[model samples]
Target: MSHTLPTDIRLHKKSRTLELIYGDINYELTAEYLRVHSPSAEVRGHGIGNGVLQTGKQLVGIKGIQPAGNYALKIIFDDGHDSGLFTWEYLLDLCQNHDQHWQDYLQQLQDAGASRNDGMIARG
Candidate 1:
């Protein structure tokens, strides 16, 4: 399934949060999650077997979400990863799997002897 970020995105001015509305669903994206789990090829890889685990992003924040044409978004993180282009379908999936995905990230950090709150990560 393919999804695209809607053209009518809403940003909360005070909280610096974002809401990507597509039809009836609204995806609330934060700087932290977007930064840590970018959907770009670098983060997601190219096949069903390629998924890079990300860590040390508990404090990471979303700087902004810029539109990348009609198909994707250029999400700028507070930690400075600005090259990933997140497509709509991926974002939807992320929203759907948020709890599981976040738990997976946390577990990865724990297994690596790292801390998203303490600035450590896997060495390889």
Candidate 2:
């Protein structure tokens, strides 16, 4: 199935959220969320089952966003991460599965004994 491209995209600097509008649906994704779920090789890795768990991204923010050709958006984060090219379909999927994805990420962090806050790892 094909996903429709967002009709509007805005970066809420103060709130650190990226707002995307697709027809009547809207999604507000946090900067930290985008940072942790980045599609870059550093985050997603080169193969399956080798994905890295991102931690300490609770306060990340978006620096800017640029259109990549006609297929994706290149998101630049305040923390110097600028490699991910978020395709329209991927963005839509993220929006649609935000809650589930977030929950899974939280569970992963907990299992790894990692905290969202910088430099802190809790012991089980």
Candidate 3:
């Protein structure tokens, strides 16, 4: 949970990708991931007490990151899931939980009888 500061940051807008260098570790963040892992209560829910599943975000992309405050960032998603304010801690959480969380999301979608043929939702 202790993350080093990023020494370098790069954004490929055309590809909706963000690359960061922190000490010896490098990270690649897709706009899609940022959009789905938005820090909004609408996304994470209140204090982790709720289980709101996010679907139909396979094609969602981050339009931009709006400054929310000194500690949080407002992420704008192309799919209109732009209400989330992602903090550095939250972003780190997303990175750490990426694999498990993504699998859970996929399973949730499958349970709901959904498919990603459209690739319009994040479920794919």
Candidate 4:
């Protein structure tokens, strides 16, 4: 499958969002969403079914983004996480499936009794 690279990328520091433009389609992804869904081993783990749940990243912001060769981007987060290399294909997937992915994440957090806020867990 071929993935079209974004024609434009913008970081909105004040809004804590990253915007990507692919022709007529535009997508804005929050920093917290990107951080939690990072394609890094630390977040995705080394094997299937071993992914880690990321919490306390509600206020995370993008520090910067750098190109990884010709196919991917290295995203830097304000919380000092800079390991993930997001490929154009992966970014497109995230943008296209944003709603479902986000809802799944929220459900996972709920199941784990976790909160988005730092160091907070809901008790019930």
Which candidate tops lDDT? 4
lDDT of each: 0.72, 0.92, 0.66, 0.93
Model 3, C-alpha of 85: deviation from truth (Å): 1.1
What are the per-residue Cα lDDT tens digits for candidate 1 across 1-124? 3345464677663565668777788777666676668877777789886967666666666777787876777877767788898777777777788898778877777786777765755465
Superposed on all Cα atoms, the candidates' RMSDs to the truth, in angstroms, are: 3.7, 1.4, 3.9, 1.2
What TM-score fits each model?
A: 0.74, 0.95, 0.72, 0.95
Candidate structures ordered by lDDT, highest first: 4, 2, 1, 3
Clashing pairs in 1: 3-89, 31-61, 31-62
Error at 4, model 2, angstroms: 2.4
Model 1 worst lDDT window (10 residues): 1-10
lDDT of 4 at 56: 90
The clash count for each model shown is 3, 0, 6, 0
What TM-score does structure 2 among the candidates reach? Answer: 0.95
Give the runs in model 1 whose Cα sits over 4 Å from its true position: 1-7, 13-16, 41-52, 121-124
TM-score of 1: 0.74
lDDT of 2 at 123: 70
lDDT of 2 by residue, 8-108 (tens): 99999999999999888889999999999999999999999889999999998999999998889999999999999998888988999999999999999
Which residue ranges in model 2 land beyond 4 Å of their true spot?
A: 1-3
In candidate 1, how many Å is residue 111 off? 1.2
